[model samples]
Target: MASVWAITLLGPARQRRSHNDDDHHTSKEEDIDLGPEPCIFTSTIPAWNCRNLERLASKTVSPLVFAHVRASTEGALADSNCHPFSRGALMWMHNGGIGGWKLGVKRRLVSDVGDRWFEAVGGSTDSEWAFALFLDSLERLGVDADDEVRQRDGFGHVVLRKAMLRAIERINGFIAALPAETREQGDVRCLLNFAVTDGKSVVCTRYVSSRTDEAASLFFSSGTSWKMQPSSETGKGAGKTQLGTGEYKMERRDRGADIVLVASEPLTFERDNWVTVPTNSVLTIHNQTVLIHPILDQYYNHTPSFLRSRGFAIAQGQTAEDRKAAITRENSAAALDGTAKEVAVA
Candidate 1:
């Protein structure tokens, strides 16, 4: 599963007040001094292990957070290859592959990025290069990736969205430029699920470069709080101590989202709480409002009934059901190819 999770807390001042030693502290002063302490906790350990995760999840509370558990189709498994790649005050993560990355596009992708961003890449992953591309795109837009001024001004949502789209466009162009023989022999479809934040606002996308291929799975759950629900069975506990056993729910007393989660798979099996982020949409979380915008490109299809076969994405991470679905799609594609060849001959 190519999953990413993120959360943003609107008011850190109100939260910090409890930690104040002075009883006479003014709320206004605290509010003015409020700045987000953003950090991302990530593990390649299948989202289930790593006892440190459980300890941190229960204790480490932040205004914003991004977590990813990768099922890699392109990169190796190492600590440096983990998601939530950071540079300066900005943190970025991706949940998909750049199409034809190993097919000479890696050279072009790396060549396009400047030395500063290029040096920051510590891992040999396409995801890291994608982040570098994003940084390069920002620089081309006149926003310095390392500039203190832009960091203070905050890279606005528009800047982020533009850079992200450019990154995708560049990847698409790179694939399109590849030799026909190479393209035909390999997959040239891109699944670009990206999440980026400057510790103030978070932006994410669920995208595919092919018009009829499903991107990786991305689901989100938002509400006032994510609490552990009572276990259906009597012997189980209802807290962090219970770990994977206890179920969780999103409590929605109001329309506001005090807590938000985005993941490749639902962290807990609360079906009603999670919603599939539309296949080609950008989800922006600012001031606690979740706005989803469709990414309109040549590959985007407006038809509601159009279904993208999830074969390629599923092949990256196979389950028993996924294996069956992939076989079905492959057989169908083969049959269609045969029919088209016969028609051409006739």
Candidate 2:
């Protein structure tokens, strides 16, 4: 239920870690290069602290960065509960909650995962527990979630996506296995919008457990560069710079997508610059190419224009609506300018 936001940069930049307890402490700063440097940088700060967030942003440099701002819903207000949970080399962020978490899902999920993952949990948030489940999923898929070599070399996108889908399936099973009366008394449907990365590739999902209901809103934007638009003060003086001061838009100079952005909501109000990730689907960004694969299951809705109710997502504090209703045709046309392909994955 915590509202989360993340940004992934595919090129080189400086990486830094800022802790809430050490606001006055000077954290170590290192450049993340393609050769031997660490691949992921994460910053978890309280959503209300604008000054600290600005200070952290000013010193950031990384090709891959995930920033999390926490709004406490299920966990105590503490730094440990802040998101972008990392284990080994993988990072995770979730914008939705597991259905019926307090009823029986929490106890069942805690007992279901392996001991290593269970003990590795550092916080009391269900979001962190979900990350543990994802790590366990990777292990069950014949991949070592903690292997140093694989962590540095990268877990292929295919493997990560498979694990993501498997974890969702397991979550659904937990909800379904609840006592009949408990399931009847509580809302057992899940609104799972997850983002995970192994530092080289990113895989995100916009999924709902009920076929008739829409998933939480997840939008993506891709282009050659996320450039700042011209402003009235540009080129006016030597000391003035408009890089971060002006509005920015996705600029497509070619077919290849040098920049890819996936977020829980449209980063900008420019509707033509964003495209909605279809419901019940997995979106993968690897080597700058975007691929979307449908998550076919009992909850999958095959209709392209299916009108799903937004009541559940709205009540959960995340909005969900039809693409046609949310984005303009020009936006869909702009999406075609990038290198996005949809391949069937059964």
Candidate 3:
């Protein structure tokens, strides 16, 4: 039930040089590849290690970087409970928790997985267990979760996306099978924002299992480069380091996205730089192209005008005010009529 503060950084791959492209005078931003292995860091007290983390990140370069800071709702403070859990080259992280996990879903999910995945769990956390489930899902799709070649090359975006969706489906099934009384005694709805990558293609989800509740807040920014802006840069303002000395900006030198970032919240206060990933949809970042696909299922909101409440997401540690322009007239009317309370911003 912990609130996972996660960040996923995807650096564009090295494009093979083509003779004709050089003659065309096309400028391409290349991500400097320092090594093959990804650099991952996790902490229960990130503030205590901010300087060390920053130093490590400054020197390391990889195609993908996944970082997590856990605000515990469950499990003891330990390294094994930290996220961006990895198996070979595949890395996984979750921002939300399994609904009614303690009520029975955990036991059911644990019992259903094979011994390999079951034994792979080294920590007492829903996030790590969820990763194990994802690995099991990949195996069920006929892909070896630990294949050396696939680990190096990647499991491919299509296969990884399918496995992610299947894992979510299985989680829903487990929650559904809970006894009726148990389900009634507690919230059975899940806020499942998951990200998985094979150091190549990355897939992320912003999903909630209820049609009337918004999922945990997730935002993404993509551009040609993530550049540092001058401190004097104007407007909404740039983000600062803990020392408050510098700022950063997402610079779009061209239409192509050479850098992609996904996070539970906007990394900077520059709201224009980020876009909210639609609820109940999977976002795929492959080959520097960002694609979003709806998760078609029973919990999907078929009505475009329906407004989902953020109350549930807020209670679960994610909060976002619905834009006034996006709220439908019907919902606005209800709010005015006292049927629904207006969301206030201080």
Off by over 4 Å in 1: 1-47, 232-245, 318-346
Model 2: lDDT of residue 154:
83
How many residue pairs clash per model?
1, 6, 0
TM-score of each: 0.78, 0.79, 0.82
- Please list the C-alpha lDDT of all candidates, in the order they appear: 0.73, 0.77, 0.79
lDDT-wise, the better of 2 and 3 is 3
Q: Determine which window of 10 residues in candidate 3 has minimal summed lDDT.
A: 1-10
Clashes (candidate 2): 6
lDDT for each residue of candidate 1 in 244-313, tens digit (9 for 90 to 100)? 5566788999988998887777777567788888888888877777788888888889899776666666
* Per-residue C-alpha lDDT of model 2 across residues 1-346, encoded as one tens digit per residue: 2333344444232445544447766666555554322333333444444564566556765666675554677787665777777876688888888899999999999999999999999999888999999999999999998887777778899999999999999999999889899998888888888888887898999999998777988888999998777554545474554555547788899888888988777777688888999889999999989999999999998887666656567667676344344334324433666734222111
Candidate order, TM-score descending: 3, 2, 1
TM-score of candidate 2 on Cα atoms, chains taken together: 0.79
lDDT of 3 by residue, 51-137 (tens): 656666677665566766657755787767878787867888888888999999999999988899999899998988989999999
Q: Residue 326 error for model 2, in Å? A: 9.2
lDDT agreement of model 3 with the native: 0.79
Kindly report which residue stretches of model 2 are placed more than 4 angstroms away from their true locations once superposed.
1-48, 233-246, 320-346
Best-fitting candidate, measured by TM-score? 3
Sort the predicted structures by lDDT, highest score first: 3, 2, 1
